[model samples]
Target: MAGKLSVLAVVALATAAVFPSSVSAQPPLPPGPVTMIVGWPAGGPSDAVARLVGAHMAKALNQPVMIDNRAGAGGNIGSDAAARARADGSTIMLATVASHGLNSALYTRLNHDPLKDFAPIGLITTSPSVLLVPRDSPLHSVRELIEKARAQPGKLNYGSGGVGSSQHLAGASFKKLAGVDIAHIPYKGTAPAMTDLMAGRVDLVLTTGAMSFIRSNKVRALAVAAPRRLPALPDVPTFDEAGLKGFHTDSWYGLVAPAGTPRPVLEQLNAALATALRDPELERQFSEQGSLPVKPMGVDEFWNFVRKQMPTAAEQVRISGAKAE
Candidate 1:
């Protein structure tokens, strides 16, 4: 028995020498390049935030971060994929309001539980939707838009990325608050919706990422859907200032890993995210785009934040009268 024990001890030492026990204790960085799934198309606000923040996060972690856009079903495709991915920290996702917050209440047949399926990494940024119109449109202000809509019910239409997007919610909220019968036009993505808006195929759009168009004068900002005007669009008036009070719909972006992802991996990812958000250039870019980076928070705090947002999102969906797919 002593000799058998000695042999077993020798084997254990050899195994330890070959593969250090510390390796198991300290998890290695994601097996290889990290893939971040964006639930929207490449040109939307969620995609933009993913690219910008992923670039910085890549530098911080010394690992390449790739963005995979699985845009469909009001951001459910990418979100579902992220939830079902291997929970090894290699595959994370840039979750948005449409996915984590509103989709639960919007989609009746959702495959994944918005809150249960994700381990929150951190909140990225948030931006208020802006009510915009084609540059040559006859409508000059929010009041004009409302009056025109009321005058010709269902004549004036608004475009949105999809049925339950932030843009959609904002447009629906506008219709409800203004008490008009404007038609809704839902597109595959915001870029296409914006394209139609520019071509005058759509009367207007309430969007979060039209800063470039607004800057170049392709679209006129009728009103910001916030309490105050954005610095990027200082001249533009808030919805309240434009005669529509209590109008607010802000979009948020955040990172999340699959629910079973190791807590250590989540910690590492959160740290890298915090480091990237600290970059002044990134902050400046976010501000210029009318999106504000959220303050850093620990994983638990972020999870709580997401939990709190779910109620507000459900209420928004109820107000918008958005139905499930």
Candidate 2:
């Protein structure tokens, strides 16, 4: 028994020397420039946040951080690429509610598993949308809109940025919770939808940066799907306050690395991310874009935050009845 124990100890020592454990093997810097994958087009909010975060992370890592834009298939293309990346700390993804939450339920088949293929670094920000109508619309409030929708059914229509977008989900949730029928009009993008909403072509829209439009007297924000009244739009009531119990939705963005990354490396990345998000400059930029920072959290806490949103996203996908096979 003593001889056997000695042999086993020798084998373990050899393994440790040959393959440094995750703790000890962690590299101070990536072997190459780190790729930060953005699943959306350049110049959008997601891309802007990615570049800002990447700049700070580059400083922290002392390595060049590259932003790779692979916008397509409603954020699935880049998401799938990130999922297939090696577990080495070099490749990471800038994930959003669409990639990590909604797409799981929206697509009939996805190459990547949103929750399992990657490690949740941390949530960066969440942009809440407000339920809006034309300033001259006959509906005055959420209740009135619902009443009219129920009375006229498909006659009332709402426009969204695209099918399966957070905007679409918000509208679907309103229809489901209010027990009304509102036809959905899919647009190429939100700008056109907002244009039509102002032109009285669409009956309603859910807007994120409603301050300018509301201030311009172009749209009337009846209720918001937010935790509280937006400081910029104080008069807009929350869905809860507007009498729609438990209704909530937001476009949340988060950071993640491919699964199996070394724990020490991921910890460093998470720390860097948390620090960058708290920067005063980043805070000002987020506010200007109408995005609010998600509360700071450690890695484990951030996982919980990401996990908690999955079910809500699934429910929204179901309500939207959107599918991409």
Candidate 3:
């Protein structure tokens, strides 16, 4: 009995040494407010998600989470700032697919490395782009639109928020897969592109933030660029279902702190992010806006996910032939 007890005691000590309790492993953030940088203008999708998730994270961290918008260079401006911020848990950034995934492939020179410059905390939400046309337009389906584009070739045009934006890539992907020659019109932002789409100045648009217009019947969603249909737009068909077999694109947001932030601090921030995402009300709000929170994941797992997405983003950038302005 004594021998058995001794062996059990040794095993327990070894286990404790290898894995500490969560309560002791996580350290508190710095005293002042945590600034969350958004690499887009306020009132944009990334800003909206940051404000929502930051409000909930503030409750979890018991510190005010301030949103700082640093809009420019396709999210590079804010991302560069976040990459340079001190790694003391005082600052973080709301990263997007644009910043971490596509920009590296789109821009020839960047100040910061997407993978090495930051530590991924967790994914916030994903917004899938939808193929939209004016409600009163004669084209009612993706097939019709593709046929028209094929017939007119460069005479037809599609509009996007910018050169390397997800919208542009989606439209590019459509042109590649459908083998059509449609001219691309780049606007300052999606708002202007959407306005042009409605006014018939542009033939079509692929955007993530046009759900309200779809719901209000102002625009008709011909297809969604996702494997499955969105709950908010169930009536819409997937691109695959609409005759384009293997098309997909999404705009995603995630939380990240500067690289070299202590692993424990990263763990703490990820925990707070997971807790905030668990709020049923937050999930409801996200769904109402046609966004979906990502499934829970630990810090390293989230980083791994981001790493795996880079190659695909690069391929899309190549397909789009987009260059930074």
| TM-score of every prediction relative to native | 0.92, 0.78, 0.85
RMSD of 1: 3.0
User: Model 1: per-residue lDDT, tens digit, 1-325?
Assistant: 9999999999999988888765475575566799999878889777788999999999989999999999888889888899999888999999888888888888877889888888989988899998889999999998888888889999989898887788888888889989999888888778889999999999999988789899998999889988888988999999899888999888988899998887889889999999998999999889888886679888999889899999999998898786653
- Whichever of 1 and 2 has more lDDT, that candidate is 1
Q: Write the per-residue lDDT of candidate 2 for residues 122-221, one digit (tens) a residue.
A: 8788888888899899988888887788888799999876665566777777788888888888665466678899899999997565555777899888
Error of 3 at 134 (Å): 2.9
Winning model by TM-score: 1
Better of 1 and 3 by lDDT: 1
lDDT of all predictions, in order shown? 0.88, 0.79, 0.84
lDDT of 3 at 108: 88
- In model 2, the runs with Cα more than 4 Å from the true position are 1-24, 29-33, 43-45, 55-59, 62-66, 134-140, 187-202, 207-220, 243-245, 316-325
Alpha-carbon lDDT of model 1: 0.88
Q: Candidate 3: misplaced stretches above 4 Å?
A: 1-27
How much is 72 displaced in model 2, in angstroms? 3.4
Distance (Å) between predicted and true CA of 259, model 1? 1.5
